[model samples]
Target: LRIIKTVPCLSRADLADSFVLQASKEKKCPDTDYLSENGICCDQCPKGYKLIEQCHAPGQRSNCTPCPTDQYMENRNFYPNCRSCKRCKRNEIPVTPCQPTQNTICQCVKDYYKFDIDGDTYECRKCKQCGVDEKEKQSCTPESNTVCECKEKYYRFKNKCEPCERQGSSFFKSTMGNSLPVCLTLFLWESKVSIFYTVIRRHATGQWSKQTVNYCTHFYLSLSAPHSHLSIPPAALSDLLYTVLDLVPIQKVKQLVRSLGVTDTEIAQAEMDNRYCREAHYQMLRVWAERKSLAGVGGQGELFDCSLMQELLDKLRKMDLGLAVQELETKYGTL
Candidate 1:
């Protein structure tokens, strides 16, 4: 092979021209270069040695011994010697093809990605399961990850899928998202658009409160005569009263009672007289009174008026209706 020599004071173009002059006419020289000291060469570093520095002259040393495992050179060179390779980062595997002349390339395990996806190179992504309904149905891939979701029978809590606990309720993907609600909680029956709320019972304390429902719709609310009548004795009124106090805020009760002409003093007396009512009643009164700046001392002193009674009855009807469905399903399997 013909060689071109690089000399001092000669531009690369001039050297090429001179080498072409000395070449055979039939050689048809495509390209040539002068080997320079401390300069990178076209060939890779030989085994057991690495190019740490390059030669600028034709006869200067253009090769260096391999760097020790502890040191490595940062760039290609034919110099004194290569630096030691850097230690791999935690949980990172270095590419074996890299050498002292090139910086180390580290990659994380398959389970980890750089900042999940579309993240910075220094970050790592982790694997996670899908939502409850999709626990056995969904998965993740390297390029894209699965979104947490609620399965057909499961609901979501804090982005985690949880099984629907309320009987007669199941996870359903509504326009809003996957949620657990009573199957027919909002349905049209007999030309009446009925909506329902839930009351979660405290097994140990027997206390009840309205379990929030995501979807709220208008209902043709009505209360049965028996549930609306406070004259039936407090024992018979416990469940009905519990249901009422749970669903309607005290401010709403006050408004309904005021509409019936019941004085705040009477409201206060009824609260004090009822032994079975929970402390939640006072909590409601305090919040409502503080909010409305109503100085009147109605602590359930007087019974709620007939309309308030009607609200209680309507709430109970929904609860009882739900309970009936749950009972039937339990006896005969899901219906």
Candidate 2:
């Protein structure tokens, strides 16, 4: 028995496991304390306070101090310094002021919604207001935006709410060779050129109307015609302006107006005159339109005209605002 008491050789893995088991058996700091650099279990700094120095020995409290002004320590932590509090941005208001143990909470101001950029940061965006032809389906809230729908007897056509035409009005009807009444709508194309075509057929009930027919086809044909010098109707032009405002981003409004020859002083004046961002943008566009009209056509008192619209579209194209141009063409018929 004393001859061969050979010891079992330990592998590197076995040594590592034995060390890990020994480490696991060591006493861990309690929830209220943290392991300090000197291998001591130190009491954690309480909420509203930060650690100034670690405890010198086991079962001892760390040196701590209250968070400074505009700073916070939200939890029991052993951090060396407190976190700085956040400030509310423009169009935002503080919902809850910062306290030593808590951070400030912020929310969007009235008529604005919170727009998150990264997950940790956000800004406020102006809430959308429904147009005259649309009705509010859902009210705006801080977390969500307004929802709009076309009003009664109005339908969405090319992203705008247009009134449904009455029967036997706004278009001429003539009999074709097949005895079907062909609806003839005169559409004014660019540069005052007229495009006349039969776009709709009379229903079996003998009642035909623009709304009841394939109005989209008529719209396509009208816009697809060759360019001419036709002036857009005043109402249509107004709608186009609104549509342009909707299509152009709020951030890019200043750049757009500047490119369209609006001076910095005028832009600043518009900002002073209008409190809301949307109103300021609309006012700037109005100023740009009036100035362009005056310079191009000797101030006919028309804020918008065919030539002005063409020039605007050209400017937008040059500025790489193709979405606005495409939307304008889709909604109001092409220039």
Candidate 3:
């Protein structure tokens, strides 16, 4: 095998030409400078044009050039460069600006929604809220999906529920079938107003002894249902009253029970059998007396002094009992 060194001291152009000529001769063809002759081999695309399509050769049209930013070519042509892209439609924001190498993009305005089943997305979504004069008819999350009932009291307007005031000839009231509404209303009234404790109904005339009995009963029932219906015989009421006014210490009750050595569960069951529900008015009175006497520095105010008050009222709309009773006393009780 023989190795040959290239001839030294030849000019760069002359050496290139000699190599081309030799290659042409060896291949039995004429030498042609394809890159320089055809005008395809430039260092970069000129200003206003981008190199989106790659070059095939120095002079060929297949090589180089596309439209600059914010432009596009609708159709292909003999020339290598492209035209600008179109602008987005009204109420639509562009997803991306037009570029020489890519397509234009856009979207719709917020507060205006357009559904698309095929998933070809092109717009923004809208917001949802209740209309004027219409209490929430229905609502939806992410948009419009709720169903609302009206507050119309007397008239049975299409979809609205009947209010208490609409239940009777003179006033709306809760009936058996509409438990939720009745419950909700009862909860609200009891929370906001007071009731009279001494009122006894004149069953004959639908009147009262010292105060309106229906209102008092309603108030009591709302605050303490199931138990409220229990007819507190004179004996029971008298015993409860005596127990409260005496202001006996709770620790004494515990001590008495402990002295008997009876299990706590048994005592609790006995209280339940008496319909005490762990919150007999007597128990609440004991707590109230204790708190009032001690005057703890950082206690939740008077009404909540009795733990049962909070425990029982939390589930209802209103959490006030003493105030409700007081208000009723002020409004209807003779004194």
In Å, residue 181's CA in model 1 sits off its true spot by 22
Candidate 3 lDDT, tens digit per residue, 1-335? 99989867889898888776665455421132122222333344443454455445534443446565676654333345566575766556666877654567655555443323222333333533433423564333322223233343212223223333433222223445633222222213212322222223355777645332212222121223443321223343344334432332333344333332335665555566557433443443344333432353244222212222222222111211222322222332211
**Residue 69 CA error for candidate 1 (Å)?**
1.6
TM-score of every candidate relative to the true structure: 0.28, 0.45, 0.23
RMSD of 1: 25.3
The positional error of residue 140 in candidate 3, measured at the CA in angstroms, is 11
Name the runs in model 3 displaced over 4 angstroms: 1-62, 72-86, 101-105, 121-129, 133-335
Question: lDDT of candidate 3 vs native?
Answer: 0.37
lDDT of 2: 0.68
Candidate 1's displacement at residue 110, Å, is 7.6
Worst 10 residues of 1 by lDDT: 326-335
**Backbone clashes in model 2:** 7
Candidate 2 Cα misplacement greater than 4 A, ranges: 1-25, 166-335
In terms of lDDT, which candidate is stronger, 2 or 3?
2
Clashes of 3: 29
Query: How high is the lDDT of residue 189 in model 1?
Result: 27
Give the whole-model CA lDDT for all candidates, comma-separated: 0.41, 0.68, 0.37
Worst 10 residues of 3 by lDDT: 313-322
Q: Please estimate how well model 1 matches the true structure, expressed as its whole-model Cα lDDT.
A: 0.41
